[model samples]
Target: MINNAPEVLRYAAFTTDPAGGNPAGVVLDATGLDAAAQLAIAAGLGYSETAFLTPGPTERSFAVRYFSPLAEVPFCGHATVATAVALADRIGPGELLFQTGAGPVPVSVTAGPDALEATLTSVEPHVLPIPQADVAEALTLLGWAAADLDPSLPARIAYAGARHLVLAAATRERLADLAYDFDGLARFMTDRDLTTLQLVWRESVGVFHVRNPFPVGGVVEDPATGAAAAAFGAYLRTLGETTPDAVLTLHQGHDLGRPGRLRVELRAGDARVRVTGAAVAIPADVA
Candidate 1:
């Protein structure tokens, strides 16, 4: 048994700027830590989610778990990107496999001129239907009406690694104005097994802006959500809104003032989706 405290590494994923994007806590060596300890660490860090890693099947692999302040999630995309980039900074850019609670996720990291970037390929993705009554309740909690929704963009639940409810707003103004019943939404999400409500607005055919309300993770919002991005790509494909092979640009976190960008790439005949972004380590002392 190990007694020493595991070191926590902080990284902001989806942007080169430390202030942009979502910040995640990474524990590179948590083999000795129990779930309780991990939870405590995550609670201390106060990020939306923190990733814990142990040795996996191969030298370039790890068994990963994600924890929020309030609960444990099956997967977390921003945390995954943060962990991969942290590993790449130490071990050099290369391919990595993460054995997660949901499934195995393949990731590739590269050292770029600006910073280290990581791309994660999601497992097989699928879209599922949500009860209209539940959707209506969610809309009420979010203070949005049925008329505010985009008719062309159907609402559904999408899963790449974790489940997210996709709701498309008709206009950018509607998407930007975010006010919700936090406790009510959290209860609703818990009962429905949802991670976030992927509130989105299509700026153009291929360009979109998104905001994720992650009540289940004990966070009011997630600045950059890679899992949701992958799921969104699958959503668009399943809806026949985009070609099977195309690049999508997602701009998130701007309203929160921590601007971030996420790249979602879909390949022809491949059910899996890929989300890529840059990550940078944050200083412990700085708030």
Candidate 2:
């Protein structure tokens, strides 16, 4: 197969409306494309990330690779959702095992009257406290004062399929006004091997607002962040914050003018976190 773009299906995950969610490129079959080719394609597409799925007839699984414009990432939430929905178009909605760089991410697809929904089970997650100095530097880059942080959620680095630092803003206003030193923040995150800075503000017991600064991925702000959602689930578990059977609703990208929602489910017995979202194909000619 020629692997030249492969019809580049565009899908906005975590929202039914294309104008509301994070856009990702989905290449159903990319067996022949090498890493360099994939990177070139992703950069050409110009979305936050793209998911390339290699064909496998094993009934439930396939090797999946995620690439940003500048580099390859271990995992990406929106792209995974887009790929699962894209697969559902051909193979019918069910379960799928994705062998990603991070680990095996099991995705389950369910058909809705409106669109297809995908739920991805993240790899086992963990959280580590961020060093004070590191936190201070990050705060400085973000132009946020330490007093603006929410004491309840403390700063920590959370990992599910990838590593992300979770910083809680004390107020919604603080979360909305996101102006940061791009180069400085990128340097800090790169030095620590962090993927994105998961900035959040808790709205209620089970509802929160989030924004992700993905400088390392060459994006200013991620409209919808699936990886950060999984990592946040782990962070909550580590802190003993949410109820075992709670379903957390995360509203992201509203400030960026593209509103998206992510449903994060935490099971009492399962160590793997589940992140659910709806995905729809972006119209080909719309650009």
Candidate 3:
């Protein structure tokens, strides 16, 4: 129903600097828009995904939906951060609730000396083993040999609102080369109900380099992936690789020239994960 640009707010999640994180589009109010309209806008913007928020005055939360150019996603982390930061700018920094298709997500925003930072606590996360056959197929599509994989970090299907296949690379070089079979991987992901392939390479125990192949979303890669970070936190816990109160840092988008950082926090006695980052506006005229 919005005939114009609808005041799209741009933000780069996970990094304080505008140049160092994943950029997302946030439409704070899209209550009247339909699926087709949402898709059209996302496609037009062409930013991996866009988040639409519908306010519910009576309720403590707002209805939220995520749309990629290709389809609707149950949840999207970077977009959520972007939306939260956008809302904070208007409504003042505070706690906000989002009712997504996956579940209710609570976000908190705080004002920093330089900029505002937002933290989102994910829904309960879980991890599942990836089938060997599927892993082989995915590896083939990505042109990655078995030796390129990291044995320490096993392949898994992790879920925190959405599902992503976590494939850890043996080296940073292997993770940087992202040329893959777009249509083939897309088909493979669709068949398995996967949102993306969370390609990664661990730099250290707490630091990692990552890339997300989102062919299903009609995007080549996601700069900073909040959902995948949450899932990866669960994946690490399931592997018994990290302590209960561990914090992981994910660096992404450097390969694509839009480098961003995502901070993931895991707490004891809580199945949910927390992802924190900062966002900034991308001028409508520029992008």
Choose the strongest candidate by lDDT.
1
Point out where model 1 deviates above 4 Å: 1-3
Candidate with top TM-score is: 1
What does the lDDT come to for candidate 3?
0.88
Give lDDT tens digits, candidate 1, residues 154-247: 7899999999999999999999999999999999998988999999999998999999998877889999999999999999999999997899
Worst 10 residues of 1 by lDDT: 1-10
lDDT of 3 by residue, 1-287 (tens): 54754766777777676766777778887877888888888888888889988886644468899999889999999999888888888878999999999999999999865678889999999999878999999999999999999999989999999999999999999998889999999999999999999999989999999999999999988888999999999999989989999999988888988888788999999999999887877654543
* Model 3, TM vs. native: 0.96
> What TM-score does each of the candidates earn?
0.98, 0.97, 0.96
lDDT of each: 0.94, 0.92, 0.88
Q: What's the CA error at residue 14 for candidate 3, in Å?
A: 2.1
Show pairs that collide, candidate 3.
Answer: 20-259, 20-260, 21-260
RMSD of each: 1.4, 1.5, 1.6
Task: Report clash pairs, candidate 2.
Answer: none
